[model samples]
Target: MRQYLPVKKFEWPWSRRDNGQNEFSPLIPKSGAAKVEDEELGHVDNEYQTGTPSNQDHNSPTRIQPHYSYSLMDYFLKYFLFLCNLVFTVLGLVVLGLGIWGLSSKESFAQEKIGTIGTDPMLILLTLGFLLTLLCLTGCVGALRENCCLLKMFSVIVLVLITIQVLFAIVAYTVQDQIEGYLRSGMLAAMVGYQDDLDLRFITDEIQLGLQCCGADTYRDWEVNLYYNCSAPGVLACGVPATCCVDPLENGTVWNSQCGVGAQLMDEFTAQSVIFLGGCLGGISRWIKQHEGLIGTVGVVVVGVQILAVFITTRLLENIHRHKAHA
Candidate 1:
């Protein structure tokens, strides 16, 4: 007389058969007890269930766990970070080469002609550009690796650097002459010993023809004697001063009966100053010429860093979304 009762619908984990096996039934309650729980409670529990179901089971792969646990994000981040660092490091190497070339360039020794050389602010621009390029690479690495502290540090450094660069550019462009004058003063300070006071005495044919030839001797008659007597001693006179000559003042020698410390020191100072400043500029130009090949390499590295950043960011976003959907 063992009779089987009708199976109820909507049984949860507690609903088991006589054999102690789960029937895998749905968890809908019967209509009779549905009136006890209010709509608000039902709504709240429903919301909670829906929200929490994604992470309830440890055995299920459909769980919203962090990708860092499996080193998924770590691998990508590391690769991208390495790329960024390598790029910047190589760029730094190139820049270092350029600096060396600048140190040895011949153009640095050439004299700058008057009204020919314009102020370019090259040193400031190059320094800032180099610093910023390094910072951007560092920031990319920090961001890729998800290092919060590094990221913050890099961000702050970059921001401050960019702000300074912008301000400098603004000021430099607005007061270009003042900036040029400042730079010129600095150069002069470094090369002021090259200044020289040149005393150039250019003697022409008139001054060379000393004591111009006088025909009064050949035509020394009564009329010539009378003409000579009536004529001034210096006016239109022959055998006057003739033949030009350059009378360069001897070093340390007094001229015009004036005596002081040796003036040759001034000439030496002028020559040395010119040499120093000319050497500086020549060195810079030489470096640019010597490391010309490195410019392309540096450009490539920079582009590579940018590309890697984009790829890593995309991969991170994709991984997050994929894991989320599965969960």
Candidate 2:
């Protein structure tokens, strides 16, 4: 009498007791031990079981995620960057060595004038070469080793330099009128050492010869030099450098060291026959005006190269991150 008839088989739409628990939508969907709704929530859950069951769970260590495959282009770009930086590094080293040699050969460290070394224009070349070498070396090693730190550092420095250059350009443009005054001051300072500083003398000579002009403003500006002043007792009194002469060589053979002697004391017509009548400032301004387009183009190219480098570095860094994540 107590025996029950065959239990009526009924299937619930959202319930199943086959696994001893109600199923739920898999949050991470691929699995054997799927996470279900909390038991204490008093809610029914659902899950779609497939024909083939997965042995892995949501927390399984062996999860299948997409892996990044580096293409040939990536490697090529990496090595190309490395090679470029390496080449620049070598060139920087050469320039730096040459600067050192120039200074050393000139005995720039001699006790008598060592204190004036800071004013030497060769320091500009040395600084540029050293900075180039440091930045390139960092970039080269960073590319070769896939080092994010070095790459970031190199990119930051380059970006900073580019920013500085842009700001300087803006400032220079804004102060264009005063630039001539600044140049005059700098020229005067350099001329003060024309006889004592070999670097200054060479630079001054080159400028005069190339521009076919004399002092900062006029040939008579040589009076600023004590040795060249009219009141000086020296034979070279009131004379300009040989570089300012109409022809710096005698008979196109011997060096005419005294060609400019007493040339500054002559009238304009007389001086015109012996030396250049124009001043250097006006020539420099004209030269700059003529080359403004070229200067702008070169600046653009340099900045473009740096921006491209930054972009390339960012991509490489991203790839590195992806590969590390995959690992």
Candidate 3:
């Protein structure tokens, strides 16, 4: 009867056994292997939640979130580039407009003259203006949006343009004799078309008046023109343009268009009194030499600006890369 009475088992909250003595037995203690296994399971759970290996947790700290650091220089450069490009964009449009106006004013787009448009000076302005507008627009948008592709394109174009300018400078300095010859030929051609082409005539007149020189080499060079040749039937034959005259105004009141009439037939000494005897080539050379310092300064500034832009673009690209890597 005494052996038949049942004893209630003491159960531990974590124990699942119907006979609960296995959880905290006085006679048979819990195995050290079981305690170690339980601790390992808890560590694996923590690692899963944190997305890290348990062993590496001690070796490395948790990753910190990434943040963009916008420096003062970054802000300055961003807006500075945008503003510079905006101004140049406007300037390019103005140049394009002026080129179109010049071409239209001279009727250079007429069907008969269309074939010659490629060689027109206005075409050069138009092409240059279009390129400048496109290039500056890229830079402006790229800076604002922080677009890598656009910035890269802008940088590459700028680099190419800078290289071209440098090469042009080098060629101009190295081929002085050839360049002078080319210039002489170009001036003569312009003079030949002076009466027929208003653009050429205006350019010729302005050069003559501004440089205080006549033709390309001398006042006699006007004979190259059909209308100004001595054998021509026109009244302008053997005469130079009024721009060649030292004082084109009569009595400092009215413009004297006939001041240079028959001046090409005059002797050098006599012509010197009526019109300039010196060539525009010498005048141009003198002007360049006189302004060489200013010219060099401007060239350096332009090159420096391009170089700075390259540097800024590189910095922005690196910053973008860093951000992406962290992300």
Candidate 4:
């Protein structure tokens, strides 16, 4: 109309040309709408970079890595148990060796002596040593290799042994009089065969020397033996062993084997001066009473150590299960 000429359209520097429509659109606009869109894009880009949005829902479960750790105490206890068990294993081997030596020295495997093998003190030592060695070895290897089966077996055996010891201790404490009677009977039986059995003779001699005691009841108790009886033809008749004498040495050096000859013929007043009048049973009882506190302390410590081993083994097992689960 007014100019009757074509009007030139103004386009922003950031605008794009629409070929057919001749429309111009800005890639980046300067309006508030453009500002809002720019902020939204920046937020999305931040989310992509950080892996999550800042406005994430609080109720949603979070993803975090599980932490597995062992403290210094754990390592210390593990090795400590291993070392303790190793020491016991060595001690067990020593005990087993001593037992074997005793049996071999005594010719206990002879056909005639084999009948008494079951009741031999060396057999007891051998059995105890073997069990200790086997059990401790299991625990040692198990701790080192973290073997669950071995640990469980060790734990079960220890538990059973503990239970047995507890029951034995209880019975010993509750029926002391009966126990003493049984001890007396056993002592008498040992005396009856003291001459025939070298093992019993050695044991009896050791008991007499260690306790400074004569016999089950008195020095005359040796007469129960067939060779020591007053009616016997041997020189040992009515004679106690040299071990029962107050002084079994002559001139302070020579062994006075005949010092106890005719000792049974002496009166109680005279015999009291030559030999110990007390029996081994009383001496044993006195010894036990005197050392009860020490015995209790040792027992408690042993039980505590076993309990600690069980606890450490259980913790290790739990750790293994946890690691496997995670894996």
Candidate 5:
């Protein structure tokens, strides 16, 4: 039979009076036969005095505790989160891969090479895509882990990156011509235009002399004949040399024979193509948005719809099965 010293007040780190030993012990209630009897007999008195808590009263602690259950709504939300994350991750990887590949290889060289799909532009696009993908992947992991903080962070980052990319793309598409010209100039700055191939009139003595001196070169000779005529008083005739010109010649001889400048319209077409592609990318973004849940609420709606559809289909199938069984 263990004996308990009468407790005054149950203070933490309780003090004990000792006979020479000075040893201290916790004031635990004794659990002997006599103590049990006392506990049973004194139960009402204890209740009146200290108010012994009932099962329900003690249950308040558990009731106040947060729920850790996984509901249907939770499952639906997770599924939607997983779906959106997966789509973004895959699409982002595709964009990053193509952007990096195009930037480094001439094999996929784009016409507006500086930044329109193939050059430095591809690298920028790739970086943005990579970041967006990473954010989505992070969001997916957070969802899997049920980490609200991580999900919020990732969502904000993705939203910001998307906005920035859209704004810049729009601006770039708007100034497509100027941008292309800038890119082209940077690419071909090392060489000069072939000056002697330009047409030059030699309708005066000084011009004729200059032509005679310079025309030894094929480019200069071509230029001289391009604008030469027999009608001028002080200039040489184009075909017969300096002495042959006496009087009038056809007006055609006054102008260069080359009818038109052979300017290529391919550059213009390429700029147009770049603008078109920008529009397409925007469309793709819209398509992706359609699949995403609102504040991640998309999952609930989808699951509900799917569940309804499944229930209907299942009933129809069951009816057919019953009909066949009867038949």
Candidate 6:
């Protein structure tokens, strides 16, 4: 959309070379200035269009556009786009492989489970990885091959993803008040399955250790687990998880697995000395509040990169069209 400064026309190698004057000379203003190839290229700053007037049909050629040549910056941007997508393609493949591994290890695709694999949690990762790989691979091949179709597909998909992310972000921000309640419910559900689900157990332990917090809302919240309930007839009854302990290691080395025993039976004052009394919800909230700036910066950077890729692809497609039109 940028208008280039009008300058004296420069002739191509096969141009008439008739002192920059030809059949179209009357149509062009007599800007009797000497040709400056470098300045003309610099001013265009993108596709360099050159008149391709044929010796047979001068009047007819005047209605057509000139042949287009790409500038150095255009080539650089195209290659840069290729490299960026190449990197993401590799990452996408890795993620896809990991998702496949996760699903295989869990036998989610077994004969009996195959019917339900679509609803399996691991399928989420597999879908994400597949889409990422397809999108980035399209960009990579399109850039390298100068294929307008593939590039346009990549641009459309990227724009859709960006729009979805922005809309999701807006909705999340609008419903911020309900998010904490959802987190608490999910945390509680995870706790109830702590002993049965390895993934949930690992996540719960990580949250406890990382934040030095105990349950969803408090240490007593562990009672939601059947084995940890006060009325349960087991050693773990009325006990919190070892991860809730203030110091779960004995002699600063061995893990004191029973450090949180009977923690739920103790008074707040007593439990404070043994295990974490606060809950992960508070810790998670504080963590987010503290690092919101970094999170926002990351979000902005991601959206900006998508925008830049779309812009680069648009320019490449434009130049390709121009070249094809005048060929």
- The prediction achieving the highest TM-score against the true structure is 3
Model 3 lDDT tens row, 192-298: 98888777888899899999999898888899999999999988999999999989998899999888889988899888999999889888889999999999999
TM-scores of the candidates in the order shown:
0.30, 0.80, 0.81, 0.79, 0.34, 0.75
Please list all clashing residue pairs in model 6, or write none if there are none.
none
Residue pairs in candidate 2 whose N, alpha carbon or C atoms collide under 3 angstroms: 23-45, 23-46, 24-46
TM-score of 5: 0.34
What's the C-alpha lDDT at position 219 in model 2?
92
For 114-161, candidate 2 gives per-residue lDDT tens digits of 997887787788888998999999999999999999999988998898
lDDT winner, 2 or 6: 6
Better of 1 and 4 by TM-score: 4
Report every candidate's CA lDDT: 0.41, 0.86, 0.87, 0.85, 0.45, 0.88
Clashes of each: 32, 3, 0, 0, 1, 0
Better of 2 and 5 by lDDT: 2
lDDT of 2: 0.86
lDDT of 1 at 172: 61
Give model 2 RMSD, 1 decimal.
13.2
For model 5, the local distance difference test gives 0.45
Higher TM-score: candidate 4 or 6?
Answer: 4
Candidate 4 worst ten-residue window by lDDT = 21-30
Worst 10 residues of 3 by lDDT: 17-26
Q: Can you rank all candidates by TM-score, best first?
A: 3, 2, 4, 6, 5, 1
User: Per-residue error at 311 for model 2, in Å?
Assistant: 1.3
Best by lDDT: 6
lDDT of 1 by residue, 126-165 (tens): 4645764676566566655655555556645645554665
On residues 258-298, what C-alpha lDDT tens digit does candidate 5 reach at each position?
22111111243432221111211223235446755562365
Give model 4's TM-score versus the native structure: 0.79
